[model samples]
Target: MTLFKTVDATELQARKTAAEEQFRGRKSGIDHFAGNDPVTGRPVGGYVEGGIEAVLVKYAEDLIPVYVEYTTKGYTLTSVGVVSINSSTWEIYMNRPAEQVKPLLDAILQKVEDDYIAEIEVYNNAIVDKAVAEQLAMAERREAKELEEATKARRERIESEVRQGLKAPDLTKPKSGKK
Candidate 1:
């Protein structure tokens, strides 16, 4: 005897729609700027944005079936996924009863959530990298400016000494009479 229940197309579609809505609600609840550096505890700027392209439901009526399918540092990226019940069938089969449709949907949405989190990490890293690079470049520019100013000041001091009849002694020549 099979435990799997056969759902009609309309019922399956309704369930799929509800699942998609739930996914959207979850996605919307996520804080777009909630990323933080693990080491520093500072806010790393990145946005979490994506959409559900499509949600597919599989109706097993004594048959089988199957399926499947980033964000800003400076540039914005769009991501879309086609979430289907069959893709997570193995997980659902192993973890929950096949007749329980909600669990199956939840499993698929959980995968989607995991993917979203991964993308958020990627964007956070990118933002941090860009900020670090900018800081390094600023430091270099400041150092170069200081060096140039010091060189100019030294040159002015030397010129002033020469004007006041103080000449630097030449060490490359032999003494006048002790050659």
Candidate 2:
């Protein structure tokens, strides 16, 4: 039996879309700003004023997922999630029902939104930081691997030359004296 779970997808999608759009209405709730230096806690100037799109592409990459996971339970609406975040203005949108069983859901969702910002602040000063770190680490690893390969190739070339008598003038030196 296929358990066809029922949910108000319109509401869900509305909530989802609202969550994504929430950023646009909000202003600079982010301590620094997206598309700015993560470590230095720099500001993206007027970009935050323009909303998420004003920030760099990388910073906005995972925003949708974060908003989604923060709002939904197995089949119920745990949180409304973000309607939008307007950095330039520093506003947050949590468009939710006012007549639900727990009116606190709105407040709770707001708190969660605050917590989301807090969570991001815990690790970053600006947006795109974690992304930049990951990219840098990956690039470093690749460069290191390439350097290792180059070194290994150089060593092999030297060894081959020595073996073929094109190099090496002290191959007979038994300095360790192991008989």
Candidate 3:
């Protein structure tokens, strides 16, 4: 489940607050986040405190894309509701005009120009990890093979010297056929 998608009016405002100039190169946001992630040294995905999505884009301030979700019931609007917490922020306060929301959202296009879907995976897939581990294991096996080859060469040298002291081969033997 995702919120603040499509870069709608409210999301545009949140983008403005976060600033598009900052989100360059990196992923936009997570599906859900619950505070920071220790493994990645970033925030984890789930839901931020107070049911808001707060992310600190690269070199940008925190983007709190507060949102709502309405589940349409059969007919009588039984489950018309909202999600995300609309609350205070420490930075400058912002409130949009009801009529000019579109224009305001449009203005953000100048700063952002275009938006792409942000994809973030929580863990490295098993296949990816397996490939990496296999590569590492192959490297170790190669090293072991080289070490074994070196030991074999040394052993052959030592054995050859011992055999030479016991009985050396005749260097001058009769030629099979005279030229």
TM-score of each: 0.35, 0.26, 0.28
Candidate closest to the true structure, highest lDDT? 1
Cα RMSDs of all predictions? 20.5, 20.9, 17.1
Instruction: List residue ranges in candidate 2 displaced over 4 A.
Output: 1-127, 166-179
Clashes counted in candidate 2 amount to: 20
lDDT of 2 by residue, 1-179 (tens): 52222344465556545754554344323434456667986766443321221221134545555445433521222243333354422212333322331343455446556655565565454445667898999999999999999999999998887877865556578677667
**Best candidate per TM-score, number?**
1
The residue pairs that clash in candidate 3, if any, are 32-45, 32-46, 33-45, 33-46, 33-47, 37-42
Better of 2 and 3 by lDDT: 2
Better of 1 and 2 by TM-score: 1
Residue 105 C-alpha lDDT in model 3: 43
Q: After superposition, how far is residue 2 of candidate 3 from its true place, in Å?
A: 24
Model 2 lDDT, residue 87, Cα: 47
- C-alpha lDDT values of all predictions: 0.50, 0.48, 0.44
For candidate 1, write residues 1-179 as lDDT tens digits: 63323334565556556656664433322454569899988876664322321223344421232221111112121143222356442211111122333554667666655655566667767777898999999999999999999999999998988867866677799787754
lDDT computed for candidate 3: 0.44
